[model samples]
Target chain A: MDFNFTPEEEAFRDEVRAFLDENLPENGTRDMEAVAEFQRRIREKRWVGFSWPKEIGGGGGSIMEQVILKEEMARRKAPALGACFMGLAWVAPALIEYGTEEQKQRFIPDILDGKYQWCTGYSEPGSGSDLASLQCRAVREGDEYIVNGQKIWTSIAMWSKWMILLVRTQTDVEAKHDGISCLLVEMESPGLTVRPIKNMAGGDMFAEVFFDDVRVPVENRLGEENQGWKVTVSALAHERSSISEVYGLTRSLERIKVLAKSCHRNGRPASEDPGFRSRFARADARIEAMRLNGMRFLTKQLRGEPLGSETSINKLHRAQLEIELGELALEIEGGLGVLVQGDSAVPDDGLWQRHALSWPEVVIGGGTPNIQKNIIAERVLGLPKD
Target chain B: MNFGFTEEQELLRAEVRKFLDQNCPLEEVRKLCETPEGFSRSLWERMAELGWVGLTISEEGGGVGLGWVDLVVVLEEVGRSLFPSPLLSTVLAAKAVDLNGTEAQKSRWLPGLADGSRIGAVAITGDEGRLDAAGIALEGRPDGDDFTLDGEKLLVMDAQNADILVVAFRTGSGEEDLSLAVVERSAKGLNIEPHRTMDLTRRMGRLHFDGVRVSADALLGSAGSAWAAIEHLQDCAAAAVCAEMVGAAEGALKLTTDFANQRVQFGQLIGRFQGVKHPLAEMFIDIESFKSLCYYAAWLLDECSPEAPLAVSRAKAYASESFARIGVDSVQLHGAVGYTWEYDIQLYLKRAKWARPAFGDAEHHYQRVAKLRGF
Candidate 1:
């Protein structure tokens, strides 16, 4: 297979590089003014939602071009594509795919413009991995749906203005996956409350959101009632398309290399220690494998084949890799690794320490490793279900 | 940026798979294992006629000039079938000659090796069985228009079946002062003794080079300068071995998975139990990931990328451990019958045990990876 891109694709890559050169500062310098200006320029070029259909105010770029754009941006360590993280990531895709024309008109522009943040409302205390068995209830009124639910691990919920929520509209059904409905609920809805949760990393990025008979317009319902499962599944599908997470992982690897060269163990650079060196090399190998796996998935997508449980392979790798990389870096730093960000003795500003503690966000969120393993076993391998 | 094989490569894989399925089944391999050479000469000629042996040889060398990507496709199937042949050793010998042989030397050796009219084997490791400069203690003393070879080469693959041997020798004291000498197996003063191996699908031999003399022209490259070529050959071999390991592991997993799907315990298919199924899933994941590494390593070698050495070690190091693990798990999942000689699973486990250490064991490659990555 040809690993080299076509000349035309190379030209697009060149264009992206030139654009980044002009707008993005060297050494990954960032300030609010520069970041805002860069976003504006990229949005003007319609590169924000580069792969989304053009009819929806997206760049409508080819998948390959989108990859190039992302590669260039990531190589330069630019800020993420849009300011509204979850909104631009999945919410907009779901809205575009399942939102009513009126709903699209109301929310799509706001998402594209990064006007406000959106958080997911999927998991609950009882519904972490077995998500479809969620017990959150929504009862349809005359023209609105009254929602009552508690969503846990709602990332960025405290800062988000809205939530893409899943609620059970019918209690009795043939299967647990049936009777679920998706709603675009305002965080300001009368009975809704968001309490930020302090994770082990001592960060408040995730929150527990509660709803007590919150009123949501029936029009805000995404897709048909009892079809939110389909909408949620499709929305998550969009998340797998780019495989850009590999770039982030690769960048982390480069940082680890630098830290290894600087940090000492046994009065020599840790990079020279047999145990540390082998561990780092193994990390490098695993990351390369993950990157190649991502490329394989991308190849399937480019061939017009839909990716399914195969994405779980990389997801499983990424889950382990995140922890592996962080731990490796921490071990290289020796005792100083225990120090947090503000400690003067801390290495890499305690980035690895934070990273080492951030495994739950990746390892447990979306789906746990066990869940991914089960999916791979049953769905991909054709093994009998557990 | 496509991470897929070309149509021709896929076709070659399928063709080899079909040919092996029909002509060189496990029973055939088992039968061949009982032979003196542990090789199937008829199957080797058939594969050669199909242009399998000369896939990586340039067209000018009297064979189809292709890349490692194409050769690996056939090699993987050969591995899957547990085919008993000297194809890998022959390819490695041919590679040594092609990479460092002079025009005259190339003309003297490549065509025969390419056409499978002559078999070849590599003698790199000595008594230590180490695949490094330290391992090549076979001394070669400079003489008038010739070099005198002395020392023992152990674990020489296909040595009994090879017409010629590419022997790595220490021409000087420096670690990098290693050179390759291509000597005919019939050279005077050379003794070949076959060694029994755990994996009977292939043969290994010990070569006692008692003052075996070869002309200066027999040297593949300049004296004390073959270290790089040797490393390159090892990378090619490692990458190829990784492909084979992936194939062999996949085969074992497939057999075990099928068994799980069919066998019942407690009135339910064993595959329905998480205990059985989860290990199967883990095996599948390892195979898939290792396959990616293997192919990527092949691609890197094909392009002669700077990353080829590291990638090769990565693929080898990872596959070496995982393939053995898969072999063990496959047997474990098969239950009592898995350990029986009557069962085919034993073939793969044996293959894995032998192949894991063939082209630098896991520990060696891991350390190589560290060195290459500038650690």
Candidate 2:
């Protein structure tokens, strides 16, 4: 197999490198204006949605080109291509796939321009991994739907101007997955309330959004009235590059390596300690494995094959890798690992501790390891259902 | 960049898989357990006829000019069958010779090896079988144009069946002052002693030498300067070992999965239990990771990338351990029958466990990686 990029691809990579060299924020810090400028320039270059169709204001790049763009951007530690994270990753893609012509004209451009933040309303306190069991209700009214629901773990709800919501429109369907529908609701609509919730790392990045008779026009529904599951399914398919996550892991591992160099055990650099070395090397190897697997996943997608349950393999690997890398950081820190951010003399301002406490986002929020394992076994390995 | 197999490489893989399916079935592996030589000579020749014996031998040397990536493709299938043979030794040793052998030396050895007329074994470790500087046990003393080699090489793979032994010996006390020599097994002062290893499909032996005199022509590369080449050869071997493991673990996991699907328990399939199925799922995950890592390492080696050394260690360190984990889980998932002698699962387990410390296990590679990444 050839690992070398074709000359044209390499030249495109060079062009991306040149752009990044000029535009990437110094040391990964981008002020508000700089972020806006970064977004504007990438939009001009059509690099924001490099693989999306040009008709949708995207770059219309090939799959490998997209991989190249991401690999380079991640290697340089550049800011994300757009300011609206969920919007770019899922909301826009979902809208493009299922939106009406008017809806596309109204929403896609704003999302591409990063006009405002977007939040998701899916899981309630009682619904998590079994998200289709959500109890949120959206009753049909003339020209509009009256929504009433409580969505816990609704990330960015407090700041987001809109929410892509999943609500139960027909509760009597034979299957749990059949009755749900997706809705786009303006956050400013009356009867909506958001109470911020602090995560274990003490960050108020998400909230509990309460919907009390918030009316959304019938036209705002995504896909068919009882087929929101398909929208959600298709939207969820737009994945963040796990290879980029591998790069992030590589950076974190490098930090731990540096920490180990300075931290000493038994009068030797912790890097020289057999235990520390073994664990660190294992982290390195696991990341490499994940990187290679990411490439395989990319290959499958490029070949027009559905990813199916294989993505769970890397998801599970990431969960364990995240936990291991976080623990390794703290292990290298020794007693100082106990200190939280802002503490005087805390290592990297307690970044490792914060990461260690924030495993829920990487592990539990999307799909717990148990859930991923079940999917892999039943779907991928063709094992009997558990 | 495309990180995938070419059409040719993919076809080679399918061919190897089909060949192993026909020539080296589980029953064949079990039958060879009783064979004194461990591997069938006819089977080796048949494989040679397929050009896999010379799979990676240089085209300039009258063999296929494929790189380590192609060799890895064949090695993975070899691992899947648990086929008893000296392909690994011959491939690895032939590579060392190709890398360092003179024109005349290549002429003398490469043709015979490529045509399956000769077999080769490489001995790089001492009795400890630890693949590191501390484990270099054989000492070389100069006798004019010849060197008298003394000291035993331990865990020499298929040494008893080899026609030539390419040995690593210390020419001086310094770790870097080591040399490699290709010696005929018929040398008067040399002996091969077989060992009953845990993995019956693959035999192990120890090479004994008492002032075994070898002419200057037998020495590979410059005298006392082959240490770097040896390390490079080890890295290549490390990559091969990882590839082999990817096959072995994948095979073992498949067997256990099939068993889990059919084996009834408490009036239900055992696989319905999360205890049985989840571990198997986890095993699948581990196997895929090993496969990916091994393939990438092979790619790096084939490309001659500067990252080859680190990638090789990473693959070896992870694949070896992951294979063992799958082996244990396979047996545990299979229950009592898995532990029986009549069962074939133990062979995979033995090879998996044996592979861990065979080529600088996880711990050794960790040190290598730490050093490479700048300890």
TM-score of chain B of each: 0.98, 0.97
State the lDDT of candidate 1 residue by residue for B322-366, as single tens digits. 899988889999999999999999999999998889788877888
- Give the Cα-based TM-score of candidate 2 against the true structure: 0.96
lDDT: worst 10-residue window of model 1 chain B:
B124-133
- Report the TM-score for the A-chain of model 2: 0.96
Instruction: Supply the global lDDT for candidate 2.
Output: 0.85
What does candidate 2's lDDT look like per residue over A1-386, in tens digits?
A: 66667889889999999998898777656377886788799888988866667898777888778878888988988878877888877788888899898888898888888889999998999999889899999999999999998999988898899899999999889989999999999999999999999987878988998889999999999888989988965533333347878888889888998888887788787887888888888888888888889888887776666777888988998999889989988888888888888899798878899899998888886789999999999998898885
Residue A340 lDDT, candidate 1, scale 0-100? 89
Supply candidate 1's per-residue lDDT for B235: 83
Q: DockQ for model 1?
A: 0.73
CAPRI quality band, candidate 2: medium
